[model samples]
Target chain A: MMLHNALDRYHDRPSSIHDLDPRVKVVVTLLGIFSVLLLPDGAWGAYFLVWCAVLAVALVARLGVGLVLRRSLVALPFALVAITLVFTLPGRTLFTLQLGAWEISASDAGLVRFSSVLVRSWLSVQMAILLVATTRIPDLLHALRHLHVPALLVTILAFMVRYLAVLLDEVTRLLRARQARSAASAQGKAGGSLLWRARVAGNMTGQLFLRSLERSDRIYNAMVARGFRGQYVTINPHRMRRRDWMALGLAFAALTMIQWLGRTLS
Target chain B: MNIALLTRLWEEVVVPRMHIPDGFLSMPVALIFWVITVALLLLAIRKTQQQLGERQIPLMGVMAAFIFAAQMINFPIAGGTSGHLLGGVLAAVMLGPWAGMLVMACVIIVQGLLFQDGGLLVMGANIFNMGLVTAALGSLYHGLAARQSKGVRLVVAGVLAWLSVVAGALFTALQLGFSGTSPFAIVVPAMLGVHMLIGIGEGLITMAALAFVMQVRPDLVAAEAVRTGGGRGWVIVGLVIALFVAVLSPIASADPDGLERVAIDMGFEEVAMTPPYELFPDYVIPFLGETPLSTILAGVIGALVVALVAFAVGRLLRQRAAAA
Candidate 1:
């Protein structure tokens, strides 16, 4: 929930990071992800160095460690699943234990693979956290459009972000009504069958969809009344400032230094 | 069966956990998913324009908001791995297939952009696998179910939903397999095998939801108008059969996911690349190295975060709409 609060806090901010063009951020983020993944497996030193570099950027962006840590935990399951490769894998076993019919073994190779995945995942998640923390959802979509992401995709995303709140409110209202009716009914009767309850829930979801469909029609009419066409036009075009270039340059420089150090050290 | 089971599934299983971290997949794989997602979006938009009138705009938005919030309520599953209703099928069942695809596409995009749930580059892949496939397949299943008995309809919806989720995972696995990290022989079986179990939970939830919807709001079933013969039945059946093939696709290799397979194959899975500052080992936990506790803490935290963010965003957008 705190993570959600943090997202809300940054959603409307016009910070320096937020000010950068979405296209630039997309490119930088993509490159950063690619470069991080490209680190040869077992490149622990390089991985740590890259992590520090990303951490530095996060600090500069004014994103707190608490926020980053909270967000990073989102990726932990995948990291754990990936780490299982070390133990489940078959090869020369470093350690083996027997439990009934199953023999659990850990492979040295699997350990290296697990660590490599953890490092890469950590680096990538940090970059993503930084991106979301800095940019507004709408701005990011616009940036994607300018960067040559398909117009249709951008439009779909825009509508999604735009209406996400409305549906949530409707759902909350529906739930409240359902709870009230259910409580009142329960007081009068032993309560409905499981099937009856499920059917009611299904009906609620179905009604929600139907209402949404009608609402979509109304929204379209409103758009047309406002002289809207099918094409989506941005209200404000994102312009990359000199500071954006400087930031990009700094990032590249840091990446280069890490790569150089990694090469020399290895 | 009971409210507790439903609540458990909604709270623990069917929510979008956004588990696969960024930088896990290769660039080529990411690019491929991106391309597929974009293409599907364009097609869905055009289809929406052709099928529905302007009313679809606000409708799509609200549906998206609903999905965003709905994702917060995950249902518990076996083996610590939970599942959530992607709602792609449910959306398609109500809004028509094309419209459902667009709604799902939007949800995934926003999640990637605002929540950082999936990477930007990989958004395309996520959409195609999660949205397009689920919507298309769900629509097909519903069509076939309509032709059969009411009992069969629920069963069909549940099975189709389960298949779609597994298929989506398989597609991702195939993408990773093609990148040369792991061969299909290893990845396909593992990913599909686990997700197959996960899909059972998906099917049960979907079936229950569909059954409830049919009982109360039969009119909302998008296919209701067309199902009374007029050759529409055949079309629906055809679509379902087509989707079956799409989901059962043999394209996926048997390789493990990119990061795990690569790490295992390359021989460097253990070298821990510690972050510069040791602020929190198990970030979601009070202390470091407590994985189970941390994971649970993280899941609860994640669910709350998604719900709040979605609620606040919905309220803000409602205000904007009213003001406009």
Candidate 2:
């Protein structure tokens, strides 16, 4: 259920941005991320503009801005890897720490770069979250196909999305079963040595693989019975409208302005 | 340590192996990886189609789903720590390398789009590190022992799985170092240190899963193992290229500092001091004063330790398999 909530973050809101073509949304999101990456480090003015643009897009999509911002915190853990730059980069020292025999200093330049990495990644992830929240998985896959993604790869993606929930359910069931059997220790922890616990999890994984393989065979047979072919056929395909093109143009203009501001301000 | 301090330490140390986000990588670095990823993926698509044909589509898709699900199932490692499966080598052993790569790529792309787990622009790097490299190692190492005894096969899988994680971490650190998000001297050790332990967990899980599958459904692994067994010339070439990169990374780290020294000697101090152009002081181990030699020495020592661990794990898995 938790995984389901994570996967099904899309909101069925009716707004101009929400109604935009999925392909347009996908391309615009990618372009936004690229522009964010291109911005100079410590360019707070440019980053502010980009975040404003993203918030505007969120508003247009009828999604709650606070919720979108909160959801994007998933990127923060990864941003910690850049924290090393705070001490490693050479610049005017803000402070120095004596740890035993070694002296370490944090630099003004390193702090700028580190925070820039965090802000840039945060803005980029917010854009991505907006794209997913506004677009359905099926429509996104269709957009990928229309955008000239390889046919087989698209098909593979389609299958993956379709079965993700089912497989996740199976995984949950497997875990629950393990929990029931796993006796607790005096400290109320799962009673097992490291090796034993690993063996259990690995065995469950193997079982899951076997079931998935056989399930795939059954799925293939059922598809064939229903006159399924090698390629998936869509009943109706989405087409870009005038507003979709207009939205894309607006996004491009905004991203370019943001990048220019970033360069000039930094 | 208090519970809060322990949890904070865990969060800081245990960075995930893949799923690099946006803004971490510079544009040129991201673009270079994108190009490399596209080229390799095109080859993978062609090769998988040639080998497995139409049936691979659904099968690979389901396996991708299975892998995604499997990643959620964490196993205890040591001292209340846990790690989950990446399933790259597992997929490669079950499917061939090309299909395995395709499966891994699909999972990463979906995670990026749906969960915002990785950046769209850097998906290429993620795929290259987590998918392409791991699958290649799977085929190269595990493929060699395809016809060996059951114990031998499991041992190889364990070691290869460990190697794949370390290699993925190394590639990621290289990318981050190149992108200027982190310095090489710092991030390299941090990533490698965490992943060395994580890689052990990877090894144990890989060995356990393979041992299980071999016991319950031997033919599944055997069939694909044979398929990848022959025609290993390309695999060898790939190994050579990987080793070349591994050897060159330290030199690459040292060369810029060397240039900075030369610039200083030539009285171009201001040019060398540009913030973006990082003229870092030469990085060296504390005991070893020189840059390149110390770095290379550290690398060799690290490799030797990893090799020793792999040898021990292999021996342990071999005995377990033989006993079973």
Candidate 3:
């Protein structure tokens, strides 16, 4: 695939983590994530364990520490908003500059809850990125199908996986053309006001939609010519091996233990 | 594409796409949305399959890819921030609500799994927030086509598109509030206040798309009649009702003492509960004299000050770091 973007850019490497069956990776990652989420708010010990476990996976996968940390910043902005909750929520108004009924308190409760949310979120995002960075889109789709995601939905994802790059190229072309024309119009009398710019965007979008519709018809004709069936055909089907199950079990046990210990202690 | 366009695309790597990231929603709230989204997707698949036979399936995929690509071409909305095409209303206008929903759901799921724009668990919530809300809003206005002018339909679609984004933001805020991340009263206003400006982009884009399509291929723009399935509309109706209640519950909880007094006076409850296992038990704040109104005022003011300081400090840090 010539198309490349930072998001979902699959990096191929030979390692045990990379070699694990995609289904096993999916289950294990989900286990790790769920445990992180299920850990009672502020169980730092378990959270540390989960982080260490993720680091272990990263080492095995040979994923760069810098790469993982950089990709993980995608969740930061959303997390920042929740961090503000620590300042706003009420419990013990430890110290305050009161303006009538309004006050600012560094509540013990809010601080704990906010940190818990942020840490859990950050860990889960790491697991998510790790799973994507190691696995191919096709393998992920196959895993989803094997896991019995509705075939129709799976097919749509498959198509999306296949055509996303192509459609993006088309959009880029359209955007280039639109921006060029808009630039010319900007030099003219009508002026490129916000509304006008938006209208041009909408027209470009309409053109894209029409083009897509026409391509769909042509693609349908081509498929029908090639004896296209209504249902999706599963390609390269693979069964879980002994190693896959072992990997899954080890992951499940570690996560379960961490979660249970965390809750019990907290 | 030109060099400039390529660089623009490269720069876009820094911006967050409109997909909701994970952990903004709590488990219970996320699970509730997932259940609702799954049910709707199942219904959507059946309806589309029935409406277009097997033909709908391929079209749905194409539509998904189209929307995904189109969303990438964002222009400015405000404050040097830009917004992109949501395409829910556009999809609903182009395809019927069911098929439009199918496309939106596919797009959202792909974004989650492929890009991690939203997490796996909360992917359903993201879809429900954006797709189902769009579908419902589109369906709500589907009846306007009876004797309405193309101009009028275009205008209505434009307004609905704007409103759909607002509705999506509402559900997201509600989910966040339920998660205890923020109070509903605070989150709703904050989410809506930002989205109100963003909604203009949606409105303009939707209106432009509608008018352009109508102009170019007037024959192809078919408006599906909205009157057929009254009972089947329950999903959207239920979602709306749920959203309003979720948005309001925080305010209700804020005045617990007054509400309890009313309950006692009306004899609606046994004055003494066996255990009192309700959500916000003893929510009253005491440092400000333990008054209901005072607590609310505290929350409002605290939220305001936090937001103001956060915005100012964020700008300062960004500028200082950049300058350095």
**Best lDDT among the predictions, by candidate number:** 2
TM-score of chain A of 2: 0.94
DockQ of each: 0.25, 0.50, 0.31
Per-residue C-alpha lDDT of model 1 across residues B138-240, encoded as one tens digit per residue: 6755435454566867776776676667667666656544443333444444455556556665566577777666666666553553532213343354344
Which TM-score values does chain B get in all models? 0.65, 0.75, 0.68
For candidate 2, report its TM-score: 0.86
Q: Candidate 2: how many backbone clashes?
A: 0
User: What stretches of model 1 exceed 4 Å from their correct place?
Assistant: A1-5, A11-15, A88-93, A172-200, A221-225, A256-264, B1-19, B49-53, B73-84, B142-155, B172-194, B197-201, B204-324
Which lDDT values do the candidates have, in the order given? 0.60, 0.74, 0.68
List candidate 3 stretches off by more than 4 Å.
A1-11, A91-103, A181-191, B1-18, B223-324
Best by TM-score: 2
Candidate 1 whole-model C-alpha lDDT, 0 to 1 = 0.60
C-alpha lDDT of candidate 3 relative to the true structure: 0.68
Compared with the true structure, what per-residue lDDT tens digits does model 2 show for residues A1-266?
12244425455678888788999999999999988888877889999988888898888777878878887887888866787677776789998766555566788987988898899999999999988888877788888989888888898888888887788778777877887887777877665688888898889888999999998898888877888776677875797789888988988998888888888878
